[model samples]
Target: MAGVESAFPTKRLSVPTADPQPSFLVFGAPRIEEAEIAEVEACLRSGWLGTGPRVAQFEQDFARWRGVTPSRVAAVNSCTAALHVSMVAANLEPESEVITTPLTFCATVNAILHAGLTPVLADVDPHTQNIDPAAIEAAITPRTRAILPVHFAGRPCDMDRIMAIANKHGLVVVEDCAHAIESEFRGRPVGTFGDFGCFSFYVTKNVVTGEGGMILGRHEESIARARILALHGMSKDAWHRFSDQGYRHYQVVECGFKYNMMDLQAAIGIHQLARVEANWQRRRQLWERYDQDLAGLPLQLPPPPEPDTRHGYHLYTVMIDETRCGIGRDGFLEAMNTARIGTGVHYLSVPEHPYYQQRFGWRPDQWPHAVRLGRQTVSLPLSPAMSHADLARVIEAVHGLIPA
Candidate 1:
């Protein structure tokens, strides 16, 4: 199908003595409201602003949103922290290995190392940019204890296949669900699929508590342990000690990290959580518009996935077809910027980074497909706030950038 040329308003947006290139069009800015402000003020004025009612309520809201019970979720300060908690929950040995993709954010690999497990690299599917289930199975060794799969760019990974593999090998599954808060796979929410799901609420994510995360688990004991792990191993969170229990008796069973979410961050979530569906719809609309408009472009767009799998559109990434466009990925990024659009690369391969290379001596040949994509995939602006004009601006920018 031929893609539409542009979705810009017929009337050009008035620009008064503009500087270079549309004032650096942003990617995923938050859409906060007065309700958020009021919540923060209430939290402040209430005299108990730590991990109080707001954080507790946010955890409940998050659980309800994902169609899971409260025992399934525990709030934390960052997804990285949540991942660390998941690793601890798995009880992986110091030399045990966790297989994951090379094309994800470094945090995914870093969490493995932080948990005292070896981070094993695996190749990704050329199309999905997700860790191939076959490759994950092949990477398993006697020391392999867990399989960590990233739901890349809010698109659901192939969970059924991955779960089957993990089940067969008796390996724990830890999901890196940073970009996929509202995503579903085969009618089931992504966070509810695995033994542990770690979600990020960083500034760029679908949901924004500014910087926070939630670790979801099925068992009560696991979630409780995660809560303890997140709260410095304290038996009493502020919620239970003061607000709920009205008592000070606390216990500390295990050593843990200080990773609890603050009341201030929870304030933003109380408001944003209500609008999650609306925001997701907005992103879906923008994705469709981009898909319709960029149909025949030289780039290789993400193809439709199987039925019942909803894309959160956390990132509308595309790969540069050097063979077709005559321009490689880096050159394409430069060209796009020149045409007045904002773009970003989701990652350079985790192995390609200096720290990993120097420490592990990881060569590009370790994960060839990931190496190829590390040089190709560029994330286009895909935010709920992005309007039709914004989509048009992106389309116009890409058209001008690509060499005909």
Candidate 2:
């Protein structure tokens, strides 16, 4: 597979080398094309780098891709902003608890705090690495206002069970879809199952917009309010206020944050969104190859995608337990870096971080599975931009690291 040409056009950053030291492979490198470059250049030339037509176009494109109406989505600066705004728009009571998985990015928890709500941790399933529905049910209290379920690593959480739990408890559902743009569960997209679905377009994400996100809402009014809240709570956005027709007066409906997505970022995202399917296919190939090559290594590979579910294949993670692999997780990271290959730790469970511990009196022991998985998890490179030679280099480096 090393020398085989890929079905998609190669976006190689470097050629295979005999040099003991070569260019360090950056994890999560985005696959950028000439179309994106041209669109960005055009956007710069238009003198409308702020939130404008490009942002509007990107939002429409994304909404269509997600099988929703244009009015159902609102673009923002980051997934963090999306989460924060969604929670605010949902009208969750201040300081009311929002249940979420421990095995997710801090932004998920922090958004609840930003929205003036308490974030309660629910332990994840050891096998699925997603928030267990039972844990969510067990964590719910009279004050629990919402459920924030992250589609961790692009695997859709058991949405049917989760929705059932949310429905039973009458809790609002705000899906953290930062890793699940292309994920679907049981023939339906992941984000649609919740009241509000938040997605990311960070530089390393499946869609590269430098820094951008979008919110999908079940109700038009909620999405419209989110749009207003995203841009300083103004009744009229900049695009409408200063369009070619004429300047229009606007009113500030409520105090809000500056979370609007810029046209410059949207320019890159428009083309990226167009190529999403092709890129997803490329990533699927790489994921399958990784499974094949990494087999028999003393590591715990991610389980197969679940039935009736479409995984986003965002990260190819493996748990390197020292007792079996003869190398600690941190040591494996160091070895990979020494070999000029890059890797990532998807996360260190929320409670493991000191800020959460000090603020909430939480401990890793409370969520043992998340803590253990966090300690051993390593995200190997998985990007459409990677060449077969690059794949071979990573595999060779990993094979060389483990003891016989």
The residue-by-residue lDDT of candidate 2 on 296-351, one tens digit each, is 79889999999999999999999999999999999999999988898999889999
Q: Which candidate's TM-score is highest?
A: 2
Candidate 2, TM-score vs. the true structure? 0.95
Count of clashes, each model: 0, 0
Any runs in candidate 1 off by more than 4 Å, and if so which? 1-21, 244-247, 338-340
Q: Clashes in model 1: which pairs?
A: none
Worst 10 residues of 2 by lDDT: 1-10
The TM-score that candidate 1 achieves is: 0.92
Best by lDDT: 2
Q: Give RMSD to native, each candidate.
A: 9.2, 8.4
Clashing pairs in 2: none
Q: Tell me model 1's lDDT, rounded to 2 decimals.
A: 0.87
C-alpha TM-scores of all predictions = 0.92, 0.95
Cα shift from native, residue 282, model 1 (Å): 0.7
lDDT of 1 by residue, 1-404 (tens): 34454554567787688555465667787777798889889888988778888898999998888888988899999999999998898777887999999999999999888888899988999888889999998999999999999999888999999999989999989999999988899999887778899999998889899999999996778888899999889988887887655688888888999999999899888888899999999988888888888887888887776588988789888888788877888998887777666788987889889999999899988899998888888999888877788888888888776744
